[model samples]
Target: MAWNEPGNQGKDPWGNRGGKDQGPPDLDEVFRKFSSRFGGGGGNFNKMGVLLVLIGAIIVWGLSGLYKIEEAERGVVLRFGEFHEIVGPGLKWKPTFIDEVYPVNIQRVNRLNASGLMLTQDENVVTVQMEVQYRIEDPHKYLFRVTNPDQSLSEALDSALRYVIGHTTMDNILTVGRDKVRRDTWEELEGIIEPYDMGLRVVDVAFKEARPPEEVKPAFDDAIAAQEDEERFVQEATAYSRQVEPQARGRAERMLREANAYRERVVLEAEGEVARFTQLLPQYEAAPEVTRERLYLETMEQVFSNTSKVMVDNKDGGSMFYLPLDKIIQGGGSAPMVEQAPANRQTSTSSSGARTTSSDNSTGRSSVRQGRN
Candidate 1:
């Protein structure tokens, strides 16, 4: 029954404890007590923690300024958008809120083109197109000194192209002076950009296209055709020379070879004939009579085979000769022999009388033989 008292409810539900008032709490006790009412309070806090975090953030952003620049780039620092200074590659720093850095492309080449229908020095309109290659040499000047550098570059290119083409003839721009036009335009454009404080390094310039206006396209085509014709003519001439020179030389060589062969054959033939004739000449000298008789007989037989003419005279007759007129009249040789020689007044009347003989040889000489006894 006493365990049921309100004051004793908390105290002696298990019985036999008397109640007493608690003392004032210490600082640790007060905190502990408050924390018990609240949950996990003021456990992980230092007074400098907020300040430390702000300082850490500042340090992180500042250290983050340590950046590398590429080999082909240049770093420039701007303080509140004003040109502060230039920086180089690798681990560079600047104050975060005050200094800003930009890495400019220093070694990269950029391209620009100027193209349009423009007027030539001859007051003819033509389309001239050119390309320029450049790189940034001064980042500060490239960034700030010029207003819209790219647009300025374009305008400069346009101006240069127009001016150059204006001073150049149509034929020059189309053919013999194309390189000059490109080079002069580059030089002029570069000069314009430099004077205006745009820091650009001009690398090279080239002509992409240049031609007469569309209205004159037909004429231009005709000109090109004529030029091609000239080139073709030159090529054909060269080809002809190349072909004809060798052919002529070959012909000359063949002729020379033929002449040499003919010369050698003639020389050999002459030597053989000389040796044979030399052998025959000695044999004739050794036996003149026998050789002569044999030659006479052989020569006589050759003559009578083609002609028949007979003449007779008395053994003792003077200045007289009688041809067999009856046989001659009877067509003995099918035609009477006419006397082709002068008539003589004498004739031999002996055992052997003068007779004319004729011989034919299929050789070098024909002969008439006269034998008398």
Candidate 2:
């Protein structure tokens, strides 16, 4: 009953004749059967499968080409390994394995430092440190214009620093000349980079430090201190001069004004004397004796105005008088009595009396003649 039995050998499980002699099913028949199950004929199945494969391939290639750029970045596109257009930040598409995109961050600032012991114009050695802040201005140039922009910038910084330091002095590099050194270095760097077009812009150049060699540091410090002292003294002297000069000028001006006033007063007084004498000349010439007597009295009045005086009237013709009034006043003693005159001459008194002066044993006599009315 089994199909593999000798009698059933000629027939297969599917009831086909000579089944043992038949190999596997025919390729054309298998294809026909598989296509019929999917409701497609043989040729249409092959074409549809090929179309689906092509579409999948195209989709994979397109997705592979899609890339993104950040807000701060720029894309440098290279088509077929050759330079192409630069693209801004956004979703970008390029042929897969054909065009390449290199994203560069243009907004970021980069820093480089250059330092070395350099020689100055005066042949002095100084260690100088400088820092350069820079940023990429052109991403294309930064990527292609120069093999390495950063390295180039660093070299330029070194060259600029050295050149500036070479032209400057050690004292300036270490002290007040720091700003000048930084500025000069910046200018020199810009000049050097300008011709290269490295697409790098220098933001700032900072002079970090400049110092003498360690072996001479102590001596330099002493020198710097001495320079500071000298400056301080000069400033103090300048301030003192500023303060004192004005006072001296004011005093000198005051003295000049006083001298001028004194001169004016003396000139005026002399002129007044001259004028008074000129006016009196005619009067004196008219009455010489009277004028002379009046002048003598006026002069005497002026002379005795400020002194302590004793007045004595010589009523008798002759008399001896003695007085120690100065000693009596100093010793707080009594005054001496007046002595009687001799009887030979008559005693006379005038409305205006004559004055006689006497000390302890000395006497001074003065005569006066009354003027006629």
Candidate 3:
């Protein structure tokens, strides 16, 4: 039956007999009644609920502090806005809202480029570009030693590059001096950053490119080409000298050997002549006239050995007959043989004290010569 029926008048769901209207149950009363079933009073139940809420808040705060750091990174911990400690890679924990962690990649290499048109020592302007490779050496110094280490390094690079370039000439910077410029800039950069303790380590400095201004590029190109040509010519000349020197030395050595040989031969021949003369001195002293005649005959034989003439002695007179043996050998005809004339035969004598007569032979006509007695 409905509670509002006449028979059920003055009765409600909560077992109240009065017919007055009833509103919803009070929250406190409901809690009190629910707590009563759990063997605790309302006051104790409220205390337990407050404790549970505090525990939940503590758990959340603890979980928020857990973080992971990669292998290449180092975590810098700051407690209450002050540097506390440094932590390595892996899972780490810090008090939430009380400590801050800044992760720095210590293993990564950073690059900075500095380039511009700068004046050189020779009052010439050149465009220079350089690249600096660096990495963090100390996380603490990198983060706290300077306001901004990266920016400071960048500025240092520029300053060092400018200083090096300003002390170098345009020709060197654009050509052979680039390597020196890079080395000097690296050294100067290290010196500039060392005292600052910025915790940055320079890996390398490379001179990217150096060139004259566009307006003068063509002229510089020509100069560079000429310089290269000069070097090439010098190298070629050096090689030629190296190659020719040995040959010239060898030729000179050969000539010296030949001259020495000739000198020795001449000296030996002269010594032989002297020895022969000494041996003949005894013979000449024993028979002066005969030795003199033999010497004259030997000398004359030696002198006429190379000639084409033949000499014949007249036995009955102190005269000589001459004939061109070489001409006769060349088919000019043999000399006529002179025969002793009989006393009855007439003889003709020439101015040279030789009798001459024309005779005919089987071959051809010949002029016969005879010495006068």
What lDDT would each prediction earn against the true structure? 0.72, 0.78, 0.81
List the candidates' TM-scores in order: 0.51, 0.59, 0.60
Please state the error at residue 278 of candidate 3 in Å: 7.5
How high is the lDDT of residue 274 in model 1?
97
User: Which pairs of residues collide in model 3?
Assistant: none
Q: Give the TM-score comparing model 3 with the true structure, all chains together.
A: 0.60
User: Tens digit of lDDT per residue, candidate 1, span 74-154?
Assistant: 888889988878877676777777888889998888998889999999998999888888889899899888778878898
Ranking by lDDT: 3, 2, 1
Q: Write the per-residue lDDT of candidate 2 for residues 308-357, one digit (tens) a residue.
A: 44334444543444444464367453332232323442222211222223
Best by lDDT: 3
Local error of candidate 1 at residue 176 (angstroms) = 2.3
Off by over 4 Å in 1: 1-49, 80-82, 231-373
Which of candidates 1 and 3 is the stronger one according to TM-score?
Answer: 3
Winning candidate number (TM-score):
3
Decide which is better by TM-score, 2 or 3. 3
